[model samples]
Target: MMASPYLQCDSEQKLQCHWGLLLPPGCVVIQTSSSLTKMGCGSSIPKNCKVGGKGRKRHSIIEEVAVFVPTIRIPVDSDVVHPLRGLVSKELVDRLSKLRAHVVSLSEEIFLLTESRLEASVEFRWKTLDDDQECCVSSAWYEVLSVVHMLAMLALFEANLMLIPKDGQVGGERKVSEDAKKDVVDSLLKASGCLDYSVHHILVQIPAQVKKSFPCYLQEGMLEAISIQALAQCVEIQLGLASECEKATLSVKRRLACELVTYFSQAHYCLSGCDTSDSYGKKLLLFLKWKCMEAKAVAYYYHGLVLDKGAEASNHISAVCCLSAAEDLVTDSKRACLSFCLASPITRVPPPWGIMKNMHKKIPDAAYRKFQMYGYLFEQDKNSAHQSLPDLPEFALSLKPEGYELPSTDSIWDNVDSQPQIQSLKEHLNDEEDEVETK
Candidate 1:
């Protein structure tokens, strides 16, 4: 029989295999033939040489594979830019730096245009012989309004610069310094004093200078009316708290309010002399009267503000009279004048509902309801009077109705040179603009 391939023998036995290289020391091997013969190669084999022996371990291939693998981290991108990078990307910073040189150039151009317009308007008014000294005073006050409008427009233009990508933060962005605030307060007070002086000058000068020259008898009265309107407008403009003015413990607001009332009262006395025959003058007079009425209305509404400090009963009564007169005098046409006059007395002294019921004459239901609502809003106690301000159907009493078209005054004035300067002034201020920025 042929020997097995795994079998090992000595040199004398054909040297088929060496037992030392074929298996671990002490290992044993078995050989068998088809006739049931068996052979062993070694005996007393090492403990580890046996399959499933104690102290032998199995290892994982996954841990060995992970040892050589590397790890990586990823991040997300967000696109955002800082605010002060004026109209220029970082790539174009050098090119955009030129904008700083021209910044004040545009500002000065706008200021000169505004100043020219004001000078022209003032010159025009100065030449009008029909206007009295009081009219001149009113005309001069236009400077204040014009200046404020100019400042506001400038502020608007500067605000547009915020859209521009700025290279660096602009100066003057922080609150004004203490010294600056003091300077502003001093300047404003000076201006206010000038206005007061102007009022006095007109009131004293106009009656002496133009009272004799006027073709109409009501010339002095008309001047007084215009002065009142001017004063009221001034009060409205300056009544709001200014930044520096707020720092001071004292305010000019109350004095301004008193002056407004005083001027309006004088205007009422003057309007009594105006006549319908003087159409141009009468129209102006009517406008001034309307302004006075509005001022009085506002004054009356706020009259109770000092009640916490214990105002007198007579003051309350006078306040009621002012409010009632204001309501009655608020008119659109001369046709309503007689009705207004008749309604004035009853409105001044509003009686109880019982008294209104006992009246001998019949009144229109709508008119009576309207007056009742007014009384409830203005004449009644705190809560009830608050309801009187706009509760009435204003449309019913308005001269101009909804969807109504009126002829343009510009068409009539097209041939006249009077309003050209004003038109030019408006156009200059509103000229083409792209962008502006402040802090």
Candidate 2:
């Protein structure tokens, strides 16, 4: 065999340059896109292109050039290789764990204090007090509820973070151990319980206390704001419960879905009075109303899932309708949010008395991504089996009794005639435009 041109060359670079020059003028030398492509090209090249062999044909030079020419390859990270690479730091996890424990302890302390105070009252009578004293009592009560709310929020964040693998891998390739799954479910259930308790205290207990204390003790605006806050919290907890119960038994999942739907329905009813006209309070209420709608969309999506997984063959059509309604709700919510953001000024306003400052923080993306995921799953498999419950007795035991009781759907439409006349989005937008023009 004739000595290969590569062997005669002083270096590989020279051989490559020579081969490049030997190629036909019109032929293009395209850079390979990846390492796999390069390897494929290397393997498929003609045998005559070997280092010591002669190429009898001119086309052999082109094949030799394709094989020997170096191509830049970018390294692609694979979740299979490093599943837990991007998870939160160990120190943060430890801190969150400690904080969650402390919150639970503090909640117990506050609940006991409130219970004792309630028991001491005679016919829920309030002691005669001046305006300042009444204000002090109101402030104290608001502060306690606010603290509980914040703690529940913190616990939720911690629980979600904990569910992420320590190795940072969130991809499906990483098979979660039974112990790890159990731990996650337990943590989430605990967090949901804390949130539910706080919401109940705010919505039911606080209102009863206010009623007993004195008329006008809590301002009307303050009471309205608090009710809205509690309702919002209720929606959040239900949505979280629905998410955590996704891998639970069909019955458990269905119960969660039912609760979610009921909560969403109630939230919608509460938000009916939210005025979106001009003031800061109205703007905040408008934002909250959009949030309620978004939450309802997610609940409907879950309800659809439950129906699809059930044994009834008729449920498939119901599932499709539920999903369709969810999509419409999401679209409307987005439009409402956009309109509210555009119409409302960014200037901060003093919150109404007893309403916490934290309540004004910008609302998060109203469950749009979550709705999309559910939609995708429904599209993928309308008949996919319900998720099997993990083998965790503690998780099962931790499920709150409240979820089992379904809310009456009739109550949702109760007193609908009494609701204030709220204008449609277009009319509201027009009113805003007219206000700007008058200015």
Candidate 3:
């Protein structure tokens, strides 16, 4: 018989059993023939455990084992750089460059169109025209005027675009390259040329056409309105260009100043001869009239500035006269427009339509302020010039406001060299007048 390893024994017997030293107190261990068994000490024994029986169950011992897994980490590069690195792509830059080029090309095309129209108008003549022929000639003239106006606007737009700063420019504070400044000045000069072309090529022909056709072209005020408007625009553009380029030559500035005076005088005369009875035509005429007055005031102000910069004491006095005349014109135009508006039936309505609503209300005040500033500068120039030439006679420098009047059409045309055909037309008109006198 095999002895149980868990059996409790006396101190003398405990010394005989070698396995007894490994057991805890009050614990019973079961030993099998094949392997060693351990059972916990408790009040009730498990059903799987048998005590000294013939059918003793064999107990098996299972050992626990631990295994380790090797872990591998691959090192990654964190300093990779992008190719573009937040910069604009070459493709996008090329597209923007192309867009600017396209705008320039378009402006040139419009300029050419205006020149062609002006040529056509200059070549045209009136010779016993029928109703259809008259209409055709009138249409052609209107087309020329439209092209001129369009060219002027496009040139002005191009000039403005050139003035705009590129990206990274600090609110136009960044110093532009000298070439860029010259380019802006050139653009403005080109715009001035376009305006001058309209006044000289188109507006001057109106009187000749009126004389040739008599009552046919002068029925409505549209042609005259357009002519005056063109003249006003020409004066405005010249003044703007002169002001923009401070380093411009004295001769160039003087020419522009004289041209301004001539154009405004021409516009005033043309408007005076216009028929303003047609409601639609009157609206356009009124708008053109007020704009012409405003532009004339500004032109005079700029002319005064130019004159004030001149070497002559006479120029300074002339500058003051111009400034004074500008002020008077602005005030008179404003009062006239206000009175006209008040007397019109459109004022009684909730909102006036047509020309009444579309009138340039701010022109008067703007012109007034501009002239006032120029007037102060003119006074300073006059004082400086007077001090420099203390011996100069006052009567020699004095400008009579009444003496300033619109020159004759022939005289105005003569001042600026006209085309050969235009000169021939003037001669023909003179011959007709001579024949009428003979009759």
Q: How do the residues 76-138 of candidate 1 rate in per-residue lDDT, one tens digit apiece?
A: 111111111222233222211222111111110001111222222221011111222221222
Tell how far residue 96 is off in model 3, in angstroms.
44
The true-versus-predicted C-alpha distance at residue 233 of model 2, in Å, is 3.6
Candidate that beats the other on TM-score, 2 or 3, i.e. the better one:
2
Give a tens-digit lDDT track for model 2, residues 1-439.
Answer: 2221112223444323322221112100111112112222233333443311233332222111100001111111111101111222233223323322332222111111212332222111111111111122332233333333333333333333333334533231223344544443443343344335444444454455554443331233333343333333433444344344446564554454444444434434543554324343455455556655655565565566666675653455456556666667666776755654554343211111111111222112223433444555546666755321111111121234122111112221233442334457886677568657755
- Best-to-worst ranking by lDDT: 3, 2, 1
Candidate 2 wrongly placed segments (more than 4 Å) = 1-218, 221-246, 250-254, 264-278, 310-313, 343-439
**Model 3, runs deviating above 4 Å:** 1-221, 249-254, 271-274, 306-318, 333-439
Give candidate 1's TM-score. 0.26
Residue-level lDDT for 298 in candidate 2: 55
* Every model's TM-score: 0.26, 0.31, 0.29
How big is the positional error of residue 88 in model 2, measured in Å on the Cα after superposition? 56
TM-score order of candidates, top first: 2, 3, 1
Worst ten in a row by lDDT for model 2: 63-72
| Alpha-carbon shift of residue 112 in model 3 (angstroms) | 29
After TM-score superposition, what is the CA distance of residue 198 in candidate 3 from its true location, in Å? Answer: 15
Query: 2 or 3: which has the higher lDDT?
Result: 3
lDDT of each: 0.28, 0.34, 0.35
